[model samples]
Each structure stands twice: as structure tokens, then as C-alpha cells.
Target: MSDKPNDLQKIRSVADYQFGKGVGEKLFPGGVKIVHSKRTGRIRHVYLEEKRLATLRPTNGLFSLNIAGAKRIMKHVKPQRLWVRVREEAEPFVARGKSVFAKHVIDADEEIRPQEEVTVTNEKGKVLAVGRAMLSGKEMKAFKRGVAVRVRRGVAEEVKKETLTLV
Candidate 1:
């Protein structure tokens, strides 16, 4: 909203808890804008000038990270939380927005819990998709018959952001 300082701090705290330390400051850097709901006066979205970064869920006080936000966070943070590494063979398919399966997951953050948001990446750590984890990291690596991450956005679609405007 108009008063970005307080809002930024709150969001930063959430990001740091959900992702990892320093990720909050990286995601919502200086000069970024926070959009709030007029009716609720709660943060609804965030942007960096023309690019949409994330959506803030007031109910849960959690952020639903967009592809751009994921990329930004991944770039700056190491040993990132909520990330799953898929094998090379699954790279193209994951980049196309397909769900990641347990068989294809090479590694994952051991702290990842089911139903949490996660970023799917290749072995090289390049982000392929942003999604929700359907299984825990332990299960993803230990099992071979279930979906791991339910992808919400893919790398290919991120390229289309330039053609679209944040609303």
C-alpha cells in the first residue's frame, strides 16, 4: 500500500520464514510497490514497476510466489527452501509446466512438507516450474509412484510476461 515500510517488513518476515534468510529483502527490494485491497486494506499483490512479483494471501499471511519472484529468490538464495530438483530428463517436461513425479526428483529440501509451495528445478539448479508440493521431500525421494510437485507456472510462460501487464 501507500505505507510500504510496515508492509514490507511484514512481507519480509513471512518470506524469510517461508523461504529462507535474506530471501525477503531480495524479493522485495527498494523501490518496489505493494498493492493493497481497497476493501480490506490488506496486501493483495506486489510489483517492481511493471513486473508482478507475488500475491499476498491475507488469510494465511503467506505469499504465493509468481515465476519472476521465484527466479529472483533462487538467484540470490543458496540452500533455498521449498525447492525440488528434478532429473535432466524431466527438465523439458517440467519447463513445459508438467507436474514433477517422484521418480524424476533427484533432490529436494528435506524440510519441505506436503501442500507447500515449491520451485522445481533441473540438476544444474535452473528453475523450471513454480508449484505446490504434493508430497514431502522424503517421500518424493523415497517413493516412485506419485506426483511430487503440482506446477503452477513454467519457464516458457515466464517469457510471456513482457507482453502482459500487471493488473
Candidate 2:
């Protein structure tokens, strides 16, 4: 018999399988782990404490799954890539024949502050990109820009304006 265990045929629930067999006890010794049997094979869902950390998606043979928190930290601290999207259709507003307005606006976030990192999203709440804020939520409404949102990665759709209802 080979050192490799037999291919898992199905995984029903947390109670149905051994702790380390599906998720590997070495990686998650005592944390809550969830696994789902897929057509291709077994998929592992790992959590640390109460936060979801990583997911093992279906692969051809073997692969590694990086925890979500680690991925988030890497993206926030030392992003390997950057992206942004134009939220709305805008034309440059010119004053005295000089360009005076930008083509996009960073929507207000309730807790946003000047010079803080923030993720820009569309009306549908899909993240368009991430950038440093040049102005506060209140200031963005009045100021033009020195880099309101740096446009790390531009999405390819026109942002739809949302209507807010006050109760």
C-alpha cells in the first residue's frame, strides 16, 4: 500500500470524519474545521478561533491553501498588485479653459479619515479598489483632489448611483 491514504469519496459533516484526516491536524490542531465533499475531491474549510482563515478549493492533484487573514495582511501591508475602478461617468469640468474636475469620486465611508487606507467600492458594495484617502468623508464632498482615491485597480463598469432613504 502507498503512503498516500485512499482518495476520500464523500464527507458528510464535522461528526462524520476524523479531525486531522481531511483538514490535517498539523495545520489546525484544535480549531474548528469544516469540509465539504466535492465532485473532484474533498475541499477543506479552516477557521482559527472564530474567523475563517482559508479554503482549499478543488485542484487537479495537490495544492496549498493560504489562510485568509495572512492573505489580507499581505494585501494590506505589502500588496503585490493594485486595482481600481471608475465609479461613474464623469467629464472634466473646466474653469477658464483649464481642466478643473476629476472623472471619479470616492464615496463616503462612515469612519473614513484623511490619509487612512480604504477600499473603494461601487453602489452594489463590490470593492473597486483600495487607496489612501486624501480627504475625510466630509472633505471629499467639497474638495477636488490631490489623490482622493489613487485608483490602484480600475474596474471596467460604470458605477451606478444609489439612492439613500432617511427614516
Candidate 3:
């Protein structure tokens, strides 16, 4: 017979490996039932009955609510900020050795507000620069013109410019 504590530890390890550290605790704090099948490697889906899902929902079935609306509904609950780590690089471009703009948009926190200070990082999570956001999360999603972030500090890489032609 196998020990219950040993079995629990093995399960926790597998959950952490699959979803990342603290994910298991966030998703299933009480505990979860794991089903292993030959068709699916190790574990398939994590199941939370409808009751559990309902408890997580805010009004009717909405997970997203504005700050004021959320406060009114869940007075006891505090708003939590979620950060997503992204892998990409953004470098500021200069024209005639004068800082002009950024070459690319690195990983973005979709919840970032305009004029907020944000940390810009490369694909390896290395801090490249810090700057103020010029656009909102939605605007950044479809931005095609104007400066997105005005870098204030850190290394800036130069980009090769193509010769312009007048028609």
C-alpha cells in the first residue's frame, strides 16, 4: 500500500510541472481529482464542478467588472493585479543619432493604463528599459502609428534604416 502523503506530494509535483508553480494552489486550493488515461499523457484536464466555477464568477457569469462595479459586488474582496511575463525584445530607434521611436513592442501587460510606468524586458526576461505608456492596452493591441513607450533608462539598440525614395 502507498502512503497518502507520498501520493499527494507526487500529485503536487506533477501539477507544478504542468501548470507552473503556484498555479495548482490558485486553481485548486482544496484539492482536485486527477484522472490518468493512456490516450492522454499523465494527467488530462483539471476538473472543477459547476458549483466551484459558479463561486468564482462575479455577476451572472462575468469574470470582468469595472473597479467601481466590482467593489460594490464584492466588498470584502480586494482587487488583485496580475502580471504576465512575455518573451520578446523592444529597442529604441534613432534617426541621425537622435532618439526617435521603438522598433518593436515587447511583451505587454494588457491591463496597463496610459502614462503608467512599465518595465520593458527582452525575450529572456532581462530588463531593457523603463518607460511611460503612451497608449492604453486596447490601443497598443492595434497600434500602427506614434510612439508607444518613451524609454527613459537602460540600453537602447540602434536599428538599420532603409533609404527613402520620393515618388
Candidate 4:
């Protein structure tokens, strides 16, 4: 509790490990608050002002990225990794939090593994959702009928909610 710097370092290291090199510093900049669990005293959530960036999962010790976190990766990380690009026909459905079918996939990072965190994007590389990969990236490209990514949060849902708030 006394060492905010240490906590930040720890989370940054985790992010780098889970995502890619140098991602920790880019994703989590200075002045971010790291929230710890009350029961276990481990890193739980990371935030900047009011918006959450990521949640450190206790089960896997990896990150479950929020929309902001996903965008950060897309924006800051070059040669984007862990992303599944879907066809235009499925964009609206996928953007609304629907699971991605392998048939709809146009491309994907071949490095992606099953159950790993991934970003679902449009052909133009706009991130539409964040999700857990149900299939390996190779499998996603080869197959045509099964689910590829189980979307956890969709940009459309978030945009709709935010739009309501603004109205």
C-alpha cells in the first residue's frame, strides 16, 4: 500500500508479459491508480481518473482488458498483435457483442492461442470488441462454422450507453 511505484511496475511488467514488450509503459502511463483487492491484497483493477483500463485476473494472473485498454493497445502498439479481423458483413453483429464465427474472419494474428485475450476489429483495423479467443488464430482462419472469439464487451454497446448519457 505504501509503494505505488512498485505496484505500477508490477502491473506494467505483467502487461508486457501478457501483451508484448514495451506495452506495459504504453498501456499504463504515469498518474494511473492501481487498485488492490481488499481480501487478497493483490492487484485487481487499474484506472485512469474514472475509466478502468484493465483488470488483473486472479485465476490466470493476466489481464482482462476493457475497451479503453483495447484501444490503447491498438493505438500504441505497432504491428498489432492478438487481433482478429472480421468481415464487413459481420461487423455490426460483432460490434454489438455477438460471438465471432470463424466464417466471418478475414484475418488474425497467427500467434494468438485459445483462451487468450484478443481484440476483434473491422477490416479497417478499428477495434470493435475485446474477447477471449475460443480458437487458435490458425484454426480461426482454417475453419468456417465454429465460434472464434467470445466477445466480452462490444464497442457498440459502450457507444450506445455513452450516447444515452450524453442525450
TM per model? 0.87, 0.33, 0.35, 0.92
Model 3 poorest ten-residue lDDT run: 50-59
lDDT of 2: 0.38
Find the number of clashing residue pairs for candidate 3.
Answer: 0
- In Å, residue 153's CA in model 1 sits off its true spot by 0.7
Clashes of 2: 8
- By lDDT, who's the top model here? 4
lDDT of 2 by residue, 40-136 (tens): 4466655656545445435432222232332343343322111122344431111011211223553464345655444454444444444445666
Which ranges in model 2 have alpha carbons more than 4 Å from their true place?
A: 1-86, 90-103, 153-167
Per-residue alpha-carbon lDDT of candidate 4 for residues 1-167, written as tens digits (9 for 90 to 100): 56556888999999999999999999999989989999999999999876789999999899999898999999999988999999999999988999999999999999999999999999999999999999999999999899999999999988898889899
| Lowest lDDT block of 10, candidate 1 | 158-167
Runs off by more than 4 Å, candidate 3: 1-103, 156-167
3 against 4, candidate with superior lDDT: 4
CA lDDT scores, all candidates in order: 0.87, 0.38, 0.38, 0.94
Please tell me which predicted candidate would have the highest TM-score against the true structure: 4
Model 3 C-alpha lDDT per residue in residues 45-118, reported as the tens digit of each score: 33344211111121222121112221222222223222112224233221122221333554366776766544
Alpha-carbon runs more than 4 Å astray in model 1: 1-5, 161-167
What local lDDT does model 3 show for residue 37? 46
How many clashes in each candidate? 0, 8, 0, 0
